[model samples]
Target: MVRPRLTIYVCQESQHGRDPQHEHEDGDSSTGTFFVYHAVYLEELTAAELTEKLAQLFRVPAQQIQQIYKQGPTGIHVLVSDEMIQNFQDESCFVLDTMKAESNDSYHIILK
Candidate 1:
């Protein structure tokens, strides 16, 4: 049987808060560094599970993720929820906003 798969682009929020006006002016609404993720699902996945996967990918605690947004037209960010994931599509892009104010370069590395 074929398994479900998705190709997603994940971006870390910039240290500076997003400015819609500036993004529009610059004409590059999606300007941040994005990491491509190819996810394959053998079974159904939940929002919490997805969060954990993202946490692992970014090397940060899952709790640090404050919000997850689906990038819309012109860089509009739409809040992602369980309901949203129910209808999630392949090749969608998302931006991760963490609780900390530091840049993504400052992500802690925990040695296990």
Candidate 2:
């Protein structure tokens, strides 16, 4: 199967609440356009666990993932764009008060 490329563009202009699909029409080409793929929603991931998971996901060494995690949110931003947070929220639900909190989120990401 073929997958559609995930293209991301960051514009210098102040714009918000715009749909990703209509980004081109909303801004000038001179801003900045980036090409990124594999943005994962972060949930039920502690810094330690996230490091291991990221290493596996990116097929890189665990030390590299640790370095990124140590850099804090900025490093994570380098690995994944913040847009995935909104994408996750829009596409998922977290029963925080439930007994099986992680199960649902994990299931949503892995299976459903």
Per-candidate TM-score against the hidden true structure: 0.47, 0.30
Q: How accurate is candidate 1 locally (lDDT)?
A: 0.52
Can you give the lDDT of residue 90 in candidate 2? 31
Stretches off by above 4 angstroms in model 1 are: 1-43, 91-112
Per-residue lDDT tens digits for candidate 1, residues 1-112, read: 6655544555543434455455534234556322333453413445666666777776678866655566566666676666766676765554444434375533221111
Best by lDDT: 1
Return the top candidate by TM-score: 1
What is the TM-score of candidate 2? Answer: 0.30
Alpha-carbon deviation at 78 in model 1, angstroms = 1.4
Go through the candidates in order and give each one's C-alpha lDDT: 0.52, 0.34
- In model 1, what is the error at residue 88, expressed in angstroms? 1.7
